[model samples]
Target chain A: MSNYLSLENVGITFKTQNGPFRALDDVSIKIEKGEYVTMIGHSGCGKSTVLNIVAGLLTATEGVVLLENKEVNAPGPDRAVVFQNHSLLPWLTVYENVRLGVDKVFAKTKSKAERDEWTKHNLKLVHMEHAMDKRPGEISGGMKQRVGIARALAMEPKVLLMDEPFGALDALTRAHLQDSVMEIQAELGNTVIMITHDVDEAVLLSDRIVMLTNGPSATIGEILTVDLPRPRNRLALAEDPHYHHLRGQVLEFLYHRQLRPAA
Target chain B: MKSNIVRLTPQQESPPEESTAVIPESASNAASTATRATKSVEKIPASTTRNYALWRASGTTLIKNIFLPVLTFLVVGVIWSYIHSHIAPEIPSIADTWTRAKEILADPLAQNGPNDMGIGWQVLYSLGRVLGGFALAAIVGIPVGFVMGMSENFQKAVQPLIQILRPVSPLAWLPIGLLLFKAVNPSAIFVIFITSIWPMIMNTAAGVKAIPKDYMNVAAVLRLGKLEITRKILLPATLPHVITGMRLSLSIAWMVIVAAEMLTGGIGIGFYVWDEWNNLNVPSIIVAIFIIGIVGIILESVMTLVHRHFDYSR
Candidate 1:
């Protein structure tokens, strides 16, 4: 089968006051349809840069990004990004935040009722239907992230991009959201590219973990395919030897091989 | 009250279970609290106790917010009375001013002529001018600010002019306004508009420039059009700052209107005070000063309410 999404030697250089800054260099990855791929690295390792390139929020300075045989040049509804900060408009309620994107993408194609259904259905998927009337300010951090996910999913994007969606959340909230995301991915079979620093998270969710080297010009250091079975329980995987082995590989790649320089 | 507590208890119990069950310990802890609350309800009528707690809380808040301020005002009044009676008898005594205030306020809408109108008419006239000038500033200044914020070149071009002109006195603009309009009313409004426009423009520009990058990123990823971006993202994000600018502009406009009216010799509180000063009516001038202060306070409080309504960052 053809690759669903591919980045062919993508690199991004930002011109800062100090000088030219190479955030990513010669990074290439091929992701198949329905794949849950996560890019994991240290804080400044250009993992987010890779995701942004695919999302078309940032243009690659050197190489090209392809989605289903088309060049990814600008942000569109095809690739919906769940920002790390859960960037829900403060003035909008949970329902309105989700509906904003839903209406934008589906207003012409679908009826008002259908669009509303899509919004409510997506919020239901994230179990955020009850707090639909509440604004982002009124809700907790975890709820806001759930709404962010709902907003992204409501677009029915060909590829879902999440940049540390649960990084700001507490451990329990993170674990719960991770489980929800895993279930959603399984059910929808949509392609996903998530950026995270947590190893256990990467192991738990991703079909493939793409590890990156430490930066100035970061690139893919290793790719580990998680061979674990579906509906992977966190408790069950805690004791499973194969899970540990896969988790250990990611840890080794991140810590031993690509150790970040001390500031 | 009883119904409210009963309704609140179930809502408080269910949210943690649905949203926060990832931390089962906290979930169960919340459940235990709900049970404990039920037990307490059986021991004592929950409504009465909750009502007492509510009453106590509100009582304390009232004391802090209202009573303390009133007490401070009383202290200031005593000091003012002492100063007027002992230090400078030429300055109207508090009692004398109170007497004049009573006489003037008894028929506040009375109009013998344009020059000899009641205190109410004077205050209303001043307020009308302030609002007129303030509205005009908002109409012109906000858009200018939007342009300044959106375009770096425009901002660079206009910023120097704003800085140079902002500190010039409102009275300085009066002559220019009189020359251009050749009318007292429009000139006064012109002075008010010029004085107030700077804060609105500066604040709105700063606010637009300070929009969080994350929101802009969201706009980009969603492929939102320019109009949609401004309507959905930019406007709401800048609302707090815009309201702040409006508040500053209003207070400055109020301050400038009085000075402008005093120069223009119109039927306003400022002109009324100046008239009283000329006639050596110290008690009437004192009353006018109090009215000016009270009106200023009311305008500021109204702006504060508006500010609080739009302030959603919390």
Candidate 2:
């Protein structure tokens, strides 16, 4: 498989008042083109730090992130991030918020009309075309996340970095978003790196799930390759024995092997 | 997910009760709760009833708002009259103050001397000076505040200097203004300008600091240039605070102009008050007080309206 995006021993250390704090260490992963990958671990496991490193929002102290044979040193439109809070400029309308990124990313590449159409098309993908004129604050949390997804997708990033994209959402909204994401993945074949805490979400969306050990310095504990077939249905998976086995392995790793120690 | 729960009803009823156990994801469970929420919402009072409820609440609030203030004013008037009759025989009664106010208001454009402009002209002069000073403060202070917010080192290095200057009375700046400008009108304007600038600078900086790191992260991920970030993100995000700062600065501007005008001795409300006191016309002074108060309230109301217009989240 082509190593379309690679994290070669990527790590980061943040300076706290106490001292230098090691957040991630010796972490590495290679992602193929059009692959959907998820990083799952308990809270404070530095999962988001890793995603930030790849998105070029944080500079890795130890390793380098390579995308399409180029160094990733700074954030660019090629690595679009869908922030957890939906970071829609609250001042801009939904159409304008998405259009802002589309305009910036396609400044020279597309006409104004083309950019507007592209923004609308991406919003439609997330079923948010109806609320295009509304502001982020006017929408429900689910709807805002949809717009956030649209904004990220409109940029046509090489790898979509979603930091706990659906983590704040209710389970139903999450499941709904997950299913739509799977459908969109099949249609667009865009490489995506999502950080999620939900077990079913990790299993349901990822082609590979990277589980990290609990942190002071978190590293990849295990990488589980999901063998579930395409067009995977959540309800159908509930009864599938192979699905149960895959779920059980993840549960064992998370619950038994890497269960969070008490304070 | 709703259908999932409804379809499991047969099993739930059969006492095997292992039906809910079959569910693996909380996704379906949340669906039931959401459906129940929608069901409860459907059971709410109709639109007209809700509207009536809303109207009733607003009506009572409006009455309370109007009633309490009127009651307080009446009490104040009664106390003023009592003080005039019994406690302080020298001071004018509330009725006398009102009559004097009516007379002064009746002929507000008259000017008897350099220090004795009519109340209308006095207010207009003060307002013009306040606005001029406040505008200058906003123009100079807002950009400085933005820069302070962008750099913590600058904030740290400069904040101590601001703290030292902020609390010095408006009068302390009066001498400096007079010394620098060598004229009365500009001196008064300078005093107002210097005194009112601190709030705008501080508030604008606070607004900038209050902006969520997520927004900056969004800007970065988009590879937005500095200009794009400022125009698209920083300006809009900081505007409400800027307005709040301006609101505060305007009031300070208004407040200091009275003192500034008093010292500068020009054709303004402050000078009119001082002139009336010199002439032993306490009633006209009382009228000036009321005019100053009403103008302050009107200015504050305008600022509040503007703040509300810009601070829209939804």
lDDT at B267, model 2: 87
Q: Where is model 1 more than 4 Å wrong at Cα? A: B1-60
List TM-score per model, in order. 0.91, 0.90
Across residues B1-314, which tens digit of lDDT does each residue of candidate 2 receive?
34344543432222222223223233343344445544545745553464454345445544555566679889988888889999998799877888998989888998888755678999999999999888898899999899999999999999999999999887788888889999989988888888778989999999999999999999999888899889989999999999999999888788888888888887898888888888899999888888898899889889978997888562
Q: Of the candidates shown, which would achieve the greatest DockQ relative to the real structure?
A: 1
Residue B289 accuracy (lDDT) in model 1: 81
What CAPRI-style quality would you assign to candidate 1? Answer: high
lDDT for each residue of candidate 1 in B1-314, tens digit (9 for 90 to 100): 34334444543333311222123443344445545556657656664575465445444544555566679889989998888878987887778788988999999999998878999999999999999999999999998998898899999999999999999897898999999999999999999899889999998998999998999988998888999888889888898888899999899888888889989997998898889889999999878888888898888888887997888875
DockQ of each: 0.82, 0.72
lDDT of 1 by residue, A212-239 (tens): 9999899988899998999899999999
